[model samples]
Target: MADLYKEIGNDSDYGSINDNSSAQTEDPQTSAPSPSPMTRHQYIVFCGIALAYFADLTSFSLIAPFYPIEAKEKDLSPVMIGFVFSVFSLVQFLSSPIFGKLLPYVGAKFMFLAGSWVAAGSNLIFGVLDELEPGTQFLVFCLVTRCVGALGASASVTAATAIIAHTFPDRTGQMMGLLELFCGVGLMVGPALGGLLYSVGGYKLPFMVLGAADTLVVIINIFLIRSSEGMESKTKGSMLAVAKIPAVWVIALTCGVASTGMGFLDPTMSPHLKEQYNLSPVFISLVYILSGSAYAIATPLWGYLSDKKRITRTLIVFGLTGGGVCFLFLGPTPLFPQVPTDQVWTVIVTVGLGSLLLGCAIVPTFIDLLNTAKWYGLPDDISTQGIVSGVFNSFFSLGAFVGPTVGGVLQQHYGFPWASTMVGFMFVIMAILIVLFGFWEYQCGKGRRRPPNNDLTRQVSVNYFGSEIDDTEENRGLLS
Candidate 1:
């Protein structure tokens, strides 16, 4: 197993012992031995990351069920409420890159623990906002706490990605997918739990309970997460270097567009169901649970397929295309006048299917970004991992920021159908762009001289993109 790890670069399907020799010789320090199978310590770290993801998302989503109602009582308008939700993503979008750049300096373990602690503190503060008399003071405090929470979420998430990539270099996609599964569970659990707690003890109880639980998870992680001392890169990585890669830009765009669909639904979906189907808040919560369940259940499978089958690109195209079609029918939009929007079953089915496909589309993005960056000549080091993770989170958060802000205004003015249609269009367009990019890659590979046996650069490209474009100056210029 150790020999296999060294010989194959832990990428058995594409790289052979001969092929990896150059990579190892070029940067032996960075090409440390890979762990082919999970170690006991690795399992502990994986579990800690999973729990941290679960806790972070649970806290993020818990407010969904009842925050708006309380906000209404405090005289906040729909747009203002939307802003409150968007602000979290806004902070994450702006702060994630900063955190990524800093990950090497602070260390992943410290960032993870400190971030979880900050998030926990914010949750406790958010619980108390309800105690303030309804006015500007209440709204101001609400935004401030949410911003703080977003900062913590960004820091923790960036660190978590770096940790995962470092710990499981070979299984980044599968691990990310599994982590997302926990996130999906959190998404499902948060609202339902929040609604229940809200019923039993009102707003304060939900935050107090979940926040306390999150703090506990952080405490356990303090012992479980090992320091990333030796894993740190000798040189700091540049976010600008990662951003300059054309393929990275494509992945980032796809992530942002896919996330927009989710963000669009968050602020708009419940009201749409309420207005059209006359469903109660409890039933609406169930709708979200159904969607989250589908998303949670499908993510791990997608991740496994991505890593094992090397179908990352295929999955993204399929997921985006299918998800777009689902969204088209989600509102049973104006474009699909034949479909009935008034039926409860239509809403449930579309939302569930859409969420599932979106999960498939999103699960492979982190690994895809990592692979693409490596293919483009970025060193596979902690700094590179940190920058890639930051880029992924930054773009996803940008979509999250844009989605709710725009969706709220669109739904308020134009109605849910049009808003849904707009998101559907974006998905389909992105899928088309990805397909076109693949075609161009194929064209570039055509008629090029076959690379030599030990050509690590060409082998890396073949491993990732299923193409054999030569690593020539001309080809690099063309790609860039």
Candidate 2:
């Protein structure tokens, strides 16, 4: 290509050849060279990661529909059930940062494999919990086992995210969206299958199936998935280094607040449905399934839009604003229906719509936040990416931990209305922050304008080998 350019430059009669070549390269009508087999291999690796992610989420969410039922049998209260659910995220939140710091040295592949095995072991134990005498012993065992499983999830999820960021640094939004699609599908399938399986056999069956699936994934990764260490940096970077950035803190806060709103439904929703409408376990799971379906469907669309239209800011602001509104209208108010007696369908429809709106906003927020982290000079290396992934998960897990724990207490005392209102207020505050910080700090702060291309500000490019390189500042500053 360089020789052709030089040859064209030497021709006085074809002075416009250089311009034509440049135009041709940029034109959609022009065909580029076919991708190498290595590119195909990268996609296969992505598939493996997706599968692992699916299994990871399924193992956890599988318990969502029926765990409350199990607790009730043991004479446990809503707060206790919420604690059982919260324990998982609590452990996950604490473990993720440690995993992040270790990722630079251990590599994502190793971390994922180890995590899968641990999670499988924990799920297997959880499956057999019914064998124990029911009561405090049972609840204690459940909490402990779930926390152990969370430890594994922390490792696997953070590593998988880091892997995606490393694999598709240039296309992180699209790839993250694809990952979320898989995860959302897993979340949907977990509850549906768990509920059905529980109806047939028991909770034991769901855990066993998901545990076995994760075990199989570990084997598949050993054989088919390539090493991710190639993308990792030789020297390690500090997690604190990434955390020091103001934008990183902001993004983490946003993710935490958003996650808290979503977490409100976990403990409170199932019980709310059962008590208010006398919904069966299967119907309860269906509610979550519908929400997960919406989430899965919307993720790719948001990702594609962020990538193609450079609408990260637009999506973030819109999603947060819209999600906040949904939360406000989530439960019965003076304006909204309270799902009165014989109004079962009304509650289902309204909650389902809220879930759909949450889906639209949450996934986009994640992609945009991660993209912003990278743009804020979060080091374009695998190790650094891993830390960012861990930090992201940590914040999200923290929110998940707090939401159910607090929301449970609120719902138990006041009702879903109070719980929903609190979550709604959080989203409202986050939306305002996004406009103030997300837009102002990066877009209109001082005298600087946001670059036309989101990545242009970073001046980074990916080579054919999938390595990130810095471009010339002059060339990078050009409008998209």
Candidate 3:
């Protein structure tokens, strides 16, 4: 690590290593050391932040099985139950908009801590809220708690993403991919745990358990994740900065619409399986776990493909169709019993497709857009990443707010099949939007010639225990 300044800071012919020269280098001294358990500090930071992702997804997704249980406990009608799921997203929509204003001022560490407190508190509150007099008010209270907890998570998500990006700015494409990988893993494990645990216990126990886990994770996070730049005195940019970019908005909308699809199925999944095939909640929970597994497996692979400069949006188009087809056809064999008698396999493929489709394409789509946004000048830091991401996520939160309610309506009127169809259409919308935005970005990036690799642009590298993490800048967009 001789002239550390030359490698990380100097924007000379040497600092931003060209593809050709990049290939020539092999020494571990100038590159990020391969991930190993020996790197305990790095592992803790990566895992801590990643666990935060698991916390958010797990906490919110924990409701999937609990939805029916909650509805019955509070004597909630169908509409009231739908409100319970959708209301949380509504709160995310309302609160995320202003978070950008406060994030830079508070810094990512503070933001992560704040979100931890909020999430833990929300869970505690949900576990102990007063009974509502009428209209299943307690049900609404649960949604409210989820929303606030998610809002609190907003800052942490940004912090974690930015911490990685800012720390490994040159390697953001892959690093971010890794970040998503962890989050996807969290998504998988959290739901599986929740689905399994909640089925064994009841609503109150699961909420308390999730709350305790979050509190513990945060305590670890406080010491584990630290910004390379320390705390930036100020993070520049606005929610409007992202909003004003039509490309950005399109990207955001894609996520919003995509999430709407996820939200549609996530809450009502228990009911759908129960009604359609007379299945147990455990079966539904298993489906979610499998879906999450698919996502976790795909995230890192997609990120690597992005580094190779393959076509990310192209992958997305197929994902939408794949996901759409899965949802369109996904259901219990008993629902269409005459078609086939192998109920388990039928459910597996449908749920697998639904899971795989969403996993294969959805996370990458948003990550690609975020990379594009960062190249446009978004700083790689937690609060800034949070605000920028939050803007996109807020749009998604809006869609989430609407998607479940719509699904509930369709289920109320027609049934599970029709409700699932409503979810598929959202993928259709996301695919269309990706086509539009990808086209726009392609044209714009095409107008500019490829700059020399050594050109005076930023360099990103990650070092753990004084070892370097190799991240290249050429891999900017998801498909590069």
Candidate 4:
């Protein structure tokens, strides 16, 4: 049995050797060796990163269930509340790129510590801010503090991405899947925990507890976390250079737009449901849990398919198009005119369906963006990964920033239909742009101009299952 096991392992390695040899003969730089397995130290770092990420997300989301109520007490309007929510994302948007650029120089571990300190400090302050004199000054103070916290949160994210790219460069998809899982868990757990804390001990307890939890994560990073030594890069490229890539710009735009669709709901959803259906914090938490659960479950599946099947482009197009439809049905639209109004059951059903679809759709967008960045002259190295991930994160934060700010103003002035319609329209337009870009890229071979990469060329003949057994130069003509 031991001999048979050895024979099977040898055969597996032999097949990989043959495939690698043939593939490299076409373009030696296009492919690299599969990444090495994780050492015990690497595993420790991974845990630290995951927990830190979870803490970051939890800090951001802990206010989800009760922020609107707190804002209302301070006599804040929906639009003002939107600005308050947007401040963090806006700060994160600006800071993420800076963190990305600095990751290699300062090290991800140091950045993580710095960021954790900032986020935890600001979060603890949020609980007591309302004790200050009320009015516009109070609102300004709240927004300012959240923005500071956003800077810290941005650092944590940048460090996390850099560590993953550095440690598991060969299996970024799988590692990222784990990252997303922790992200979904944080998002799901934060709101539920917040709601429970709010019910039991009022508003300040959630912030205090979550803030302390984040600080604990900071302590872990300081002690257990170490750099992925020897994985550093000294590339001199800038964000401007990455932005010059047409495909990267397109992917970034898609990310921002997709994020906008979800962001529109953040400040508005809790209040809207409370007004429309009178949902308690606990019930409201359930809505977020369902959506987050769908996202968490679908993320790994989508990542697996993209990696194993190499159907990244196909999935992107399909997911975006389908997600747009979900947004339409989510809003007050003709498509779902029959989804009953003035009932808790209606809100539960419609929102659940929309969240599920949105979850499945969002999984493809980031992976493809990360995958496409390599094709557009960003070398597959730690330095380049920092910039690419930063840009990717910045665009998403930009959307998050815009969605709440604009959605608040729209909802306040124009009502739910207008805001929801605006979001749905953005998704539909993004889907169209992505499709057009693919056709133009295919026809002109623009994506192939930079590197000797065959990703765009190979994608021509792939079936939905990702089978490309005949993917070769000879088959390129068939696509034409």
Q: Give candidate 4's whole-model lDDT.
A: 0.68
Q: Estimate TM-scores for all models.
A: 0.85, 0.78, 0.72, 0.79
Distance from true position, residue 134, model 1, in Å?
Answer: 3.3
Q: Write the per-residue lDDT of candidate 2 for residues 69-160, one digit (tens) a residue.
A: 88788788876887787788889889898898888788888888888889888988999998777778888898888888899889988888
Clashing residue pairs, candidate 1? none
Per-residue error for 51 in candidate 3, Å, reads 2.3
Deviation (Å) of 250 in candidate 4 = 0.6
Worst 10 residues of 2 by lDDT: 7-16
TM-score of 1: 0.85
lDDT of 1 at 183: 90
lDDT of 1 by residue, 86-130 (tens): 899999999999999898888878888999999999998999998
Worst 10 residues of 4 by lDDT: 8-17
lDDT leaderboard ranking? 1, 2, 4, 3
What ordering of candidates by TM-score runs from best to worst?
1, 4, 2, 3
Q: After superposing candidate 4, which stretches have Cα over 4 Å from the reference?
A: 1-38, 75-78, 199-203, 268-284, 335-350, 412-418, 444-480
Best by TM-score: 1
Q: Write the per-residue lDDT of candidate 3 for residues 343-434, one digit (tens) a residue.
A: 55666787766766665565555555555454444444554465665575577678777777776677778777667765676677778777
